[model samples]
Target chain A: MARPTIADIAERVGVSKGAVSFALNGRPGVAEATRARILQVAKEMNWRPHSAARALGGARADAVGLVIARPASTLGVEPFFAQLLSGLQAGLSRQSVAMHLMIVEDVEAETEVYRDWASAHRVDGFIIVDLKVRDPRIEVLEELGVPSVVLGGPGRHGSLSSVWADDREAMLSVADYLAALGHRRLAHVAGLPEFHHTQRRMRALRDSSRRLGLAETVSTTTDFSDAEGAAATRALLSRARRPTAIVYDSDVMALAGLGVAGEMGVRVPDELSIVAFDDSVLTRIAHPAITALSRDTFAYGRRLAEVMLALIEEPERRRDVKTATPRLVVRESTAPPGAWQGD
Target chain B: MARPTIADIAERVGVSKGAVSFALNGRPGVAEATRARILQVAKEMNWRPHSAARALGGARADAVGLVIARPASTLGVEPFFAQLLSGLQAGLSRQSVAMHLMIVEDVEAETEVYRDWASAHRVDGFIIVDLKVRDPRIEVLEELGVPSVVLGGPGRHGSLSSVWADDREAMLSVADYLAALGHRRLAHVAGLPEFHHTQRRMRALRDSSRRLGLAETVSTTTDFSDAEGAAATRALLSRARRPTAIVYDSDVMALAGLGVAGEMGVRVPDELSIVAFDDSVLTRIAHPAITALSRDTFAYGRRLAEVMLALIEEPERRRDVKTATPRLVVRESTAPPGAWQGD
Candidate 1:
C-alpha cells in the first residue's frame, strides 16, 4: 500500500520539507500556527511515521520492552497475557512502536533484563505485567530511570503509572452474582497466591462474603494449572460440607473444574453452580458454557500501551488508567442451587 | 546472580584479557592452542555473551525475530503458538540470543515486517511459522537475503532451511490408529485450509484411507477457532452417513467438538470416537480426556530457534531439521465404533 509520506504532507501544506520536519518532530523552528497547519495536513494525508527512519534519525528507539517474569511453560497456558500482548502490539503498531517481549525465570532475572534494556537504551519504556505485592520491578525501573507503565494495580506501585482492571470490584460482582443465585456454601479456586491481583481478588471475595452475610465461603490457592485446578475442585468438593457453587480464577481452571464435575457425576447448576474469571473461547465452548467475569482484555492492553507511550513522551505527566470492573456474563453454568432437583 | 565475565575467564585461564576476547569473539589474533584453552575456560566460567554488548561490538544483532501473523483474539486461544514461543524463548535464552516477537494481521503485512526488520537489521534471522504452500514470504526473504528458518514444511519454500514435523506421517498414523479400531467411516475437521501442514495432513489422510481400504473419509476446514470447529463438527455429524470417528486439528477445537457432542446427547467413545491434534492441557482436562497426537512443542520451538541461529551464523548452511512424528496418546476419547451399543 502506498502510504502518505512526510514529503506528501509537506507538499499538501505548501511548506518546505525542513519546516514540515520541524513541525513533525515538535522542534522549535516551526511557528505554532504553521505547526498546527502541517499537522492537520499530515493527519488528512494519513502520514504515519516509520519507526526505522525515526530510529535512524536518533529521535526515538521507536520501541517498548515488556519482560514477563514467568517460566515459558507458565506463559504458554495463560491466554490473558497473550490477549493483552496482542492488544499492546495493535496499539503500539498504530504509533509504529515496536514491542520487545521477553520471558524470564523470576523477578531477579526480570530486574536484570530491565537493567540491561535501560543501560542499552534498547527500549524507550516498558510495560510491566504480573505485578507482585511490593513489586521489585518498580524500584529497579525507578533506579534505572526507565519510563514504565504497570499493567495491574490501583494499590502501591510507588508513583509509576498503571493500567488495571478493578480486580476487587470484579470479584465483588462475581460473589454478588453467585449469592443472588441462591447459593449458600461457596468455594473459590484462586490463582497464584503471590500475584497482586490474586491477593486483591481473594480479599474482595472474603470481604464481600462477610458484607453480604453469605452462609459459608472457602478459598484455595493454585498455580493456575489445569491439573491443579481440577485437584482444587476435587479437594473442595470432598470437604465435610460441600459448597453448592464454585468460582474459578481463570477460564481454563473453570473448564477443568467442569470436567472434574463430569467425572464425579455432579450435575452443573443442579447439584452445583460454576463461575469463572477471564472469559475466552474455553469458557464459551464448554458443555454448558461457563458464566464468567467478562472484560475487554484487548482494549485493556491497548490502553496500557497508550499509557506507556504517554509516560515515555510526557515524563512530567502521570496517568493512572483504571478499567471498569469486569461484568458477569451468565451463560449456562450458573443457576439457583438445586432448583432443578425441585422440578 | 552475578554471572562470570570475560575477565573472570581470563583470570581463571591465566591468559591475557585480549586473548580471551579474541577467542570469545572468534577473531584471528589468538593462537590455536591458546584459543582452545581460553574457550574451555570461558565455558567453565559460564561467560555467556551479552547481547547488547555484542551488538555494540559491531557483531550481528544477536537476536532472532519471530512474527506471528494472526489477530490477538486468535493468538490468545491457541495454546500451540504460545507453547511453541515458550520453547523458542527457552532455546534462544540458552545462547543469549534475544527473541524479537511481533504479531501481524496477514501474510502481506507479515512480509512487510520481514522487509522492515531486514532493512533495519533489527534481527539477525527469523523463525517463520504458519508456512503456506508457495509461501510469498520465501521469495521476500530470499530477495532481502535475510536468514530464516520456516517452522512447518517439507515442501516448496525456495530452498530456505526448515524445521518440520512429519505432518504426513502423523496423519497416516492417526488414520491407521482409527481404522484399526474398526472405524470404517471417518471425518477430519482440519484447521485453516491455506496452511501447508493442513494440506499435507489432508493428503496424508486421504492416501492412508485409500491404502487401508476404509469405507469412507470426509474432510472439512475451519479457521481454527472453537466456534468454527464446533460448526464443522455439527455439519459433519449431520451428513447422510455420519463418520463413526472424527479428527480435529487442535485441542481447543476438539474440546469444542466434545461440547457439541454433549449438547446432542452423543456419548464420546460410546456413540462417537474423537481424536485431536497438538495435545496440551486442554486435551488432558476434557471430560473423557481426548486422545491426541502428542509432541514436545516446547522442544520443537527450542529446536527452531537453534536452527535459526545456525542459519544466521552460517549463511552458507542449509539445515533442515525434521522433528519426530507426533505419536497418538490414547486417552478415554477413542474406542471401537458402537462398542457401547452392545452393552
Candidate 2:
C-alpha cells in the first residue's frame, strides 16, 4: 500500500506543486518534455491522480457523470452492455475518466438525471443506451449541452451521434440461414417489445421469413433471459408440430432452449434445429453446436468505445450510422430438416 | 426528447426553486405534505433532478467503484462477472447504487487507480476483485477508510472482508460425488497460479482427490477462460489413457471442453466425464447437459452485496468470512464410469 502522492513526486522532481498538478492534468502550460518527465516519475512512483480530484479543478470534479436510464437489473443481464463497457474501458484507460454509471428505472427519472449531473458537473457526458420509441434523454442531453453518444441506431432523436449493431440484418440473417436449411417453419424468441432494437429485429425476422416463403412464428418475452428463453422453448415444443428451427434474441434464452429440448426428449438439430444471435460459448458446448448469427462481442465493445471517443473528441462530427454485419457461424445445431418437420 | 426539468416542475407547482430542490434531495425541514405536493408536481411534469446536481455536497459521490486488472478483451467474454453483476444490481436496486467498473491492463495501473478514486472520492467504497498474492490494496483502503469488500476469499490482505464460495467444500463435494460414481482416475483443469482463489481451490481439489484414493491428475492454465479450457481438454484427451473425469475452474471452459470431446469423438461421462465450478449457462446447455457444482450465482451476488452493505454501515464491525456452499447439479453430463456414460 505504498501509494506515492503527487507531493512526494513534486518534492523529488524539484517542481512546484502547482506545476506538477498542471503537468499531471495535461494542461497546456507545461512543456512537453517536462510533462513527460513528470508522467514518467509518476509512473515509476505508481502515482495515479484521482478521478474525484481531477473533476474538482473546474468543470471536471469531485464527480464523473454519464447519462444512463434503464433498470439496473435489465442492463446487468444484457451481454451487450457488458461487452460495450469492456470496450468503453479500453478507450478510457488511456486517460483518467472515472465513470459514474446511473440506473434510472424509467423515462421520467432519465429526464432529471441529466440536469442534476450537469448542474453538479458530476459527469463528463452521457452514454445514452436503449434509445426508446420516444427517447427523451437525447433532448435532455442536447438542452443541457452535455457531450454524449447514442448507443443505438439512428432514431427520431435526430441530432445525436450513434453507435449501434444492425439488429435488422442480424435477424434477417438468422431467418435466411434457417430457411436455407430446408426448414419451412421457424420461430423467433424476441426481447421486450418496448425496446426499439427488439422491435426492429422482430420486424426484420418476420419480414425475412415472409420473403423466404417460410412459416414465421414469433413469440415475445419481457426479458432477454435464459429462464424466459426456456419457457418459450417449452411452449414451442409442446405444440403438436414444433418449428424445425427456433431463433432466440439472446444467448441466455438460446442456452435455455437446450434444456427444454432435453426435458421434452427432443434431439437438437435432428428434431429441433436451433439458431441464435450470439456466437458465445454457451451455444458451442451443446451437443451439435447451435448455428448462430455470430458477431464479435469484443469487437462490439471496441467499436462502441471508438464511437464514444469520436463523440468526446469531435462533438460536431456528423453522427454516423455505423453498422456491424452480424456474421453467421454455421455450427452443428442447424442441419437440413431431417426429422420432426411440420408439413 | 421533451425531457422535463426542475424549473418546469416548480413552475407547474408554483413553488420556490429551493423548496423543490430540498424536497427532491430528500432533505429535512420541508413540510411533509408540502414535500408530497412538490414530488407530485415533479412527477406530473416528468422532471428529473439532473445527476450532475448530485455533486453539490460531499466528496463521496453516489457511484460505487470496481477495478479489474484483467484485460478488457477478456473481461467482456467472462459470464461469471456478468452474472454476479446482475445479482449485485438486484441488491444495488434495493439501495440505488450505481457502479463505476474499470478494467485496467495491469496490477500497477490498477493500484494507482484505487489511489486516484479514493483520494477524489469517485466512489464511497469499492468492490475489490481478483485477489492476488501479497495484495497491497488492504492497507491503502484502510488508510483511506473506504468501504471495500474483496470478491475472492481472504488473501494476504488481513483486514478487508471478503465474499467467496467455499472452495474446499466444493472440491470435497465434487470428489465425493465422482468417487461414489466409481471414478478412480480424476483430473483437475485448474486456473491461473497467481489468482488467490485458484490456488486455494486447486490445493483443495488435489487434497480431496488424494483422500478419495483416486489417481489424481492436475493440469494448470494461466487463464480462467473458455479457450484455455478447451485447450486443456484437448491436451488431456490426446493422452493415450486420459483420466475418467476432468474438473474445470469455470463453466465456459467446460463448454469448450465439451467441444473438444466432439472433435475427438470422445464421449462425455463415459469417455471423459466433466464437472465444472461456477455454474452458468455454458455448462448448462451442453448436449449432455454438464452436471456441475451449482452455486446460485445470483444468490452469491446478493449475499456479496449484503456483506458489503454491512461493512459500509458499520466500518467498526469486525470483518467476517462468508462463504456459499456448492450443491451438486447432476445434469446429463455426469454418470458412473461406463454406466449411463456417453460412450
Candidate 3:
C-alpha cells in the first residue's frame, strides 16, 4: 500500500492541498469544522506529517540535545549523572520537550554530534555538561548559533547561557570545616583534571592549604571511577606521611575509599577521616555515613531546563544563573586527627 | 543573514541543483572532483540539508526512542537503569544513533509519546522497558507498524520483538539458595505489581515456597524507592513471626532494608538475612555487602540496542532474544536463621 500524502487527504476531504496543510499544521486559515473533517480523513487514511516538511515550514522540533563525552562504564555508577538526567527529563518533559541524549568518546566526537544535530534541526537547543577548561566545544556551539546552556560556568562560556553552582566556594567550605577540626594534612581524590569544576575545586583546596599554613595538601585526579578512587586512596594511605583526612569528588568513590580504609584496618573518624564532594542515598546509608557536600542535583537539572527553555523562547535573553552553593553535611566519617602511631 | 540553500551552493559551484543534491547526499552521478568541489562550496556557504527534506526523501532519522514510565526520583538511585542507559548509549552511539529519551508519568503517557514520535518520524524505532501484564502498548505499537524491542518479556508481547532475562528462573535460584541456607520463612520486597517481571517473580517465590514446604512466604509490592523498601522492611520486622530472609527487587531498596534492620538492631545474616534481586557497585561496597541476583546491566543494554538495530534494519525478521539469566551472588547479607530468645 502506498503511504498517504497531504494531496491524498486534500482529495478525500474535497479541500485544496494548502487548506489541508493549514489544518494539519494547526494554522489559522482553515475553518474549525473543515479542519475537524480534514483531520478525521487524515487519521482514517493513516497519514502522518513528514517531519522534514514541518522543519521546512519552520515548526519547532520540540527537543533538546545533551551530548556527554564520558566513559559509559563510569557514567552508569555515578548517581550525580543519573539524578541530573532524571531532573532534566522531569523539567523538560513538563514543557513537552524531549531530550536527545548521546554519549561520545571525546570532545571531537561530541562537537561533531552537536554540528550534526544542529544542521539536521534535530533539537531546538542543547544542554552542555562537564564543562572543560578552555573548552573547545564552546567555540563550536557559539559558531553554530544554536541556543545552548552550559551546565557548568559562571563566566568561561562565550555568549552561551549557563546554570552553575559555585564549585570553588563549596570546596572551600569543606576545607574550612576540616581545618577547623585540626586536620592539618589533607588529600583530595578529584575527578577529571580537565573539567572546569575539578580545577576550581583543586584550586580551592590549594588556596585553603596555603592560607591555613597546613603541612601539606595533595590533590590526585581520577576518571571518577570507584577503582581509580580506591587506587588513589591506597597510594595516599601507603605513604609515610599520610594525610589525616581524605575528600572524594563523588559518593561512589568515597564509599570505595571507605572500603579501602576498612581493608587497610584504618577505622573511619578514629584513624582517618573521609568526605565526599557529592551526596546521594549511598552516602546517607553507608555504615559510617561519609560526610558530603549536599546539593539537590535533581533541582539543579530542573533549573537548567528552565534556563534552556527561556533561552530558546527568546534567544537574546541569555543570562548566567548561579545556584546555591553545596553545603557540607557532616556525618560519622569526619573527626579531629587522633593519636596515630603509624604516622 | 539568511540561511543558504542548495541553489546557492549550485550557483556558486556552477553545477545543476540535481548534481549538488547528489553530491551533498553522498549519492552517485556526480564526478568525484565535481562532488568534492560542490561539497566545498556547500560548506563555505554554510548550507545545511533541511532535515525535513531528507526525511521526505526517506532518509533514516538516526535516532531511537526510549520512553520510561517510572517516577523520576526513584529512577535516579537505581543502578540498574543508569547502567542500562549507559550501555544502551555505548552501543547506539557506535552506530551514530542518538536516543530520544523521555520519562512519562504512566503507560498512557508513554504510549502517547510513541504515537507522536511515530507520526512525526522523530525516531527510527523504540526501546520499551518495564513490560506489564496484558500490555496495551504492544497492540498500539503493532498497529503503528514501528519497529520496537521490549526490554522485559519472554512472552505476552504480541507481534513485537523482545530482549529479556529469565526473571522466573533468576528468582527461583535466589529462593533455592536461601532455602538451602535453612531459611524457611522468606519474604520478598517486589517492585511495581503491574510489571510482568514482578508478577513472574512473585509467582516464582510462591512456587518455591510450595515446592520446599516453607512455613510461610510473603511478597509485598512497592514503587521501588528506598523509602518504600524501608517501610516494607519495617512492617515485616514488626510482625510477631518475622521472616528470617528478605529478598528486595533492587539494590537501592535492599540497602534501605539493610538500614532498617540496623535501626531495629536486627543483625544481618544472624537475625534477618537480606537479598537484593538487582546488583551494582552499591551491593558490593555496603558494610557487610549484599547477596544479590547479579547480571551485567550494561551488557544487557548493549544487547537491547543491537536487537533494536537489527529489527529496524530488517522489520520482517522478528525474533525474541533471551539473554543470560542473572545468577545469585552470595555475600555477607544472607544466612540461616540464628539463635533468638525473643521470638
Q: What share of the true interface contacts does each candidate keep?
A: 0.37, 0.51, 0.77
Model 3 whole-model lDDT (C-alpha atoms): 0.90
Scored by TM against the true chain B, the candidates give 0.83, 0.82, 0.94
Candidate 3's residue-wise lDDT over B113-217, tens digit each?
887888788889999888999899998899888898998888999889999999999999988988898888899999999999999999999999999988999
Backbone clashes in model 1: 0
lDDT of 1 at A142: 72
Candidate 1: list runs displaced more than 4 Å.
A1-57, A259-267, A337-343, B1-57, B261-267, B339-343
Local error of candidate 3 at B208, Å? 1.0
How does residue A185 of candidate 3 score in lDDT?
Answer: 90
What lDDT does candidate 1 reach at residue B312? 79
- Quote the lDDT for B324 in model 3: 99
Compute DockQ for each candidate against the true complex: 0.22, 0.37, 0.69
| lDDT of model 1, residue B286 | 71
Best by lDDT: 3
Residue B72 Cα positional deviation in candidate 2, in Å, after optimal superposition: 1.4
> What would the per-residue lDDT of candidate 2 be over residues B1-343, giving only the tens digit for each residue?
3346677777877887788888998998779998999998877655654433333244346667888787777765667777777677557546756677667767778776777776555676788877876777767777666788888775566677778767778878888888898887777888888878778877787787678777655757548777788788888887766778988888778877877887899887667788888776566556677888887677677777788777777867856666658888888888788844322
Q: What is the interface RMSD of each candidate, in Å?
A: 6.7, 5.0, 1.9
lDDT of each: 0.82, 0.72, 0.90
- Residue lDDT tens for model 1, A278-298: 997678766688999998888
